[model samples]
Structure formats: structure tokens, C-alpha cells
Target: MSRRQRAASLAQGLLVGMTLGYTAYRAVTLAVNARRFPRLDRPHAPLRQRPRVSLLTPARDEAHNVPKLLQGLLSQGADEVILLDDNSSDGTGDLARDLCRGVPGARVISGAPLPDGWSGKNWACQQLSQAASGEVLIFVDADVEWHAGALDAVLAELERSGADLLSCWPRQDVGSAGERLITPYIDLYLLTLLPYPAMRLPLVATATAVGQVMVFRRSSYDAVGGHQLVQGDVLEDVLFAKRLKARGYRVLGALGGERIGVRMYQDYASSVNGYAKSWLPVHGNSRLLLSVALAGQFCVYTLPWMLDFPGARLLRVTGLLERSAVAWTAGRRRPADLAEGLLGPIGPLLQLPVYHKAIRRKVKWKGRVYEQ
Candidate 1:
């Protein structure tokens, strides 16, 4: 090879090495932290007696999932479960109404008409928050099914920790091949940015919350202007978390692991399109950064395989060590006999092109079309 080409290759190799090293370092830390801290599932007394909670769900054409979700909420020892129907044509509204009539302390309200420039889900949530009469407001999605103790456990965690907001990273159930490829990357990116270890410490101002399950103190929500603060944001959950931090509110986040679970997407197309819809917006509408991020994502996921080719597998060895180190440090429990490191090798490839298209196309979510 020519000297110039060799220099370029070496530079790429070094970049890959650095990325892998960082990944391993993060993984090891995450795993060790998991072992160090006791689990957060044990029972605790609610901070106050009979603390009223309004569990709000925003739904648009989520008829299929709403029933199960409502059943799960009813089983929870909460004060109320409120459903905000965002004008669904698919009988989601009717189903919600039925559940409301059947269950005590359950109510369904018609969401106000969508105003221009506002995301539908955010608008619906804002209306629900306004109507709710609870000391604590919990926003749980229609697709989420919680365990019996989820409500009690989460409330106890928030009250004990004195956090204004608490969000759980629910266990993701990926049934399709597409999900297997895409869902893991979601957690990977989350960990890369918001390390589990850092979450337990006060040094970092950074955090993230799954929209599937989020609980907020009524005061904290109003202080940050609630959903109004993130009206037009597609990634409202992240933006809401940011507002909480900005207002000097401590936000607590944890791995729900088996504690919570959600089936986010039904198929590959929806899964890919779902990410393309908000991944760019999450970075603040910067296409330039989006392009660069896509490139970096692919390189970090794929480079080790390329460099390890026609060789003594040093590059591949480095990649595996890096992956294992990250997996361990993330503190997520995995079977000792299983091999999950290879999944990351191709995970980004599945997501990068989808994001590229998402940046170019309009996203249709919750019966609204958003142009990129």
C-alpha cells in the first residue's frame, strides 16, 4: 500500500481502537456498579399518607394495547388512571371510555384539538396534566404494562431519593429480527451518553427518561411548565428531563430491567421509521451533526471487523474485549454462557440508513405529519 493510504488506514484503526477502549471502560464500570448497589424493588412506605396520584396515558389509535395497559394500571394501588384520547379513529377512545366506566377512579377525557406547531402527544399530555388533581403525576404510555408493585415501588423510590422526577428504562421486548437489531442499540446509545454509574452520582448533570414510564411531582411538572415546555418537541421525554435539570430538580433514572417492560414497535418498518422520526430532532435539528453522527455510528459498530480481516485477530480481540467490558460495566445482567458482543458489530448498520431516510422524509406519527 502507498504511504498516504497506509497512514489513512492507521488513523482509522487508531480511532476504532480509541472508541472500543472507551466502550469497554464504560461497560466494566456499569457492571461493577450494578453489583455494588442493592436492587430498588424492595417495599417502602410512601412519603406521605394517601398521596393522590394521577396516572395519565396519551393515546392515538392505540386500541389494541390500551385494554391491557388499563388492566395493569387498575391492578396497581394508585388513586386514579386518566386516559387522554387524542382523536383516534381506531376505537381507542371508545375502549378508553369503556375502561373508565368499568373501573373505579378511572376517567377518560377528549384531548383538545391539536394546535399548529405542537406535537400531538405533548399536547395531549399537557391537557391531562391540567385536568389531573394529584400530588404526583405519572405519565405512562398505552403500550406499557406495569407489574402490581410498579407504582408503589416507583413512588417509594422517588420519595426516598427526594427526586422531583423519576423515569425507568423498562425492559424492551424485541420479538422480530428487526427489533433484535435495532432495540439493543437504543440502550447502547443511552448508556454511551448517560452512563449508569454517572446516574448514581451527582457529578454529571446529564440524564435520560423513557417516555414509556415517567413520574413527576405535581410541583416539579408545573415549575418546568409541564408539557407546554416541550410542545413541539418530537423527543419530548428528553427535553422534559432537560427542563427538570435546568430548574435545579434532581431527576432519578434506573434500569427497570425485569421490573418494567414495553413492546415499542410491531415491525421493522415501524421500528426504523420511529427512530428516523426523532433521532435527528433529539440532536436539535442539525442535519450536519446528524450526518456526522450516522457516519460515526457505523464506523464504531463495523470497523473492528474490517481491520481484523486477513490478520491475527488482534483487532477482533480488541473489539470483543471492548464489548464485554461495556456490557459488564453497564451492570445489566446477562447469562454467562451467552454471546451478545457480536450484536453490536452490525447493530448500527441497521439504524444508520434508516436515520438517513428519516432525515429526508416526513414522519407520520399519532395521525400527524411532521416534515424533516
Candidate 2:
């Protein structure tokens, strides 16, 4: 065989071998590191002393979804449910107050004007935190819905783990074909790459938090400067987790599939824009890192399917299976999304333009322009 043919054969072998090795590693890590919330139906002895729990939500132009979240929080028996309408042109503040009228311990606070150095959500959450009168603070997004006993389950997990902060991954409620093609990757990356158990280890910087639903002990929140430390950060959840980890606090992340759900975006356009706002900051606002990361994602997820060299089919099948397995482990149950995981690279590929926009400080979210 010619030198070129021999080189091609070696590369094919390497691809197949690497795929198999990585798949096995993911499977093992998932089994050991992935933590799932207890089912609501499962019986557990109630805590003798229920701590005061506050439910905090920040909203901007989320008038349509805030009512649902309010209803869910009201049902959860929180001591206080505080909503911040973040300087929305839409009547979000009025709608929130109307929804909570006559509901004991529920209040809506109009967010102060955006301060010079703070992101909108961060400012909103800081206001909520200050107004909170509970020992345990739970932050839920307006788009998220909680099942019966969700709060109890989260508190139970937090107590059991002895974590200073606990974050839960909600089940993705996909609406559009675009959502199916894109959203599953969030879980796939976490399952495959993040060392979930190491989040609690001292001196280890590995940390991740889902902002959709996070429960924090008031003490821990205060210790980390609450959201104040990450005031300007677009990805506040991640930075908060890192801050907690850096302070030698225990941070635990669990699957909330049985307890909480979120419809992250309505359609293709929203998904592109919504993800870009958070994704850009997660890469440290570095265009070079974003490019390298996207290229790596394509190689690991898309190249196998696109290539026709010997053993390519084996590598492709392995890639698809690996993604599907990780997605399932992360609480994605939709058959369509599982199938779409085969085309996982599409999500990252579509975000290339968004990354460029983000680097240029041109990304708009909730009608607010954020400068990088």
C-alpha cells in the first residue's frame, strides 16, 4: 500500500478506538457522578423542622409565563415568593402583582433601573435576595414549572448532601423542531465532560450550575457575595458555582427531571439568540476558545458521520449512541430529541454566528444590549 493509504488506515483506526474509549468513559462517569432527585411519589419522612424557604424569580418581558411560575410557587408552600420585574416595558410588574394578589407572603418588586455595572438579571436577583426572609433561597426562572412536592424534594436533597448550594437540571420541554435539534446538547455536554462529583471537592475548580432552578443556603449566598460577585457576568450561574467551589463550600448538582421542567425557547430564532447570550460568556468571551471548542465539537460529533473512510461507520454509530446515552442520562426523554442527537454538531455549527456577535458585543437579550 502507498504511504498515503497507510496513513489513512491509521487515522481510521485511531478514530474508532478513541470513540470506543470515550463512550466507555462517559458511561462510567455518568453512573458514578450523575445524581437524580427522588421521585415525588417516593415516600420519605418529612423534616421535623422545616426551614423557612423563599422562592425568588426575576423577569423581564416574561409576563406570559410569570403567572404559571407564580401558581407553582404558591402551591409549593414557600414562606415568601418574591418576583422582580426587571424594568420591563411590558406590564410584567403589574401582571405579577395581580397574579399574587391576596396570596399570603407573595410580593412583586419593580426592579430598579439598570445600574452602570450590573447585568439585568443579576441586579434583579440581588434585589430578590435582599428582600428574601428565608434561611433557604430558591431561584427559579419564569419559564420553569415545578411539580407537586418539587420544593420538598429539592430541600431534601440539599439537606442530605450537606451542600452549601444545590442546582437541579429541569427536564427540557421542547416545542419546535429547532429546539429538538439544539437543546439536548446542553445535557450531553454536561454528562460527557463535567465531573459532577468533583464539584464538592476542595481546591478543585470543576463546577457547573443550571440557573433554571437553584437552591442556596442563605449563609452560602452571603458568603459568596451572593450574585454581587458576578454582577457583570452573563453566565452568573456558572460563576456563582465557581465562587462557591473556590470558597471551599460544597456545591451539588442533581437531575430534577421528576420535579421541574422548562421551555427554554419558542422557536429557531429565539433558541439561537437565547443560547448565545449565555454560551459566549461561558467560553470567557474569547473568540479563539469558542472557535477551538466548536471545531472540537464538530470533530467529535460530526466528522465521524461525514467521513467515508474505513471504520467510519463504526465511529459514527458510536458517536450517535454516546450522545443518546448522555442525553438520556441528563433527563432528556423525548424520542425526537434522542434521534436528533445524531446530528448534534448542528447545534454548535449554528451558534458560530452568535459567537461572533457576542464577541463583537452586539448580542441583544430581553431588548437589552450587552457589551462584552
List the candidates' TM-scores in order. Answer: 0.86, 0.90
Residue range 43-158, candidate 1, lDDT tens digits? 46765755799899999999989978888888886888899888899999888788779677898999888999888989989999999998999998888878767777777777
Candidate 1's C-alpha runs over 4 A off are 1-13, 36-50, 200-205, 309-341
lDDT of prediction 2: 0.78
lDDT, model 1, position 111 = 88
Global lDDT for candidate 1? Answer: 0.72
Clashes in candidate 1: how many?
11
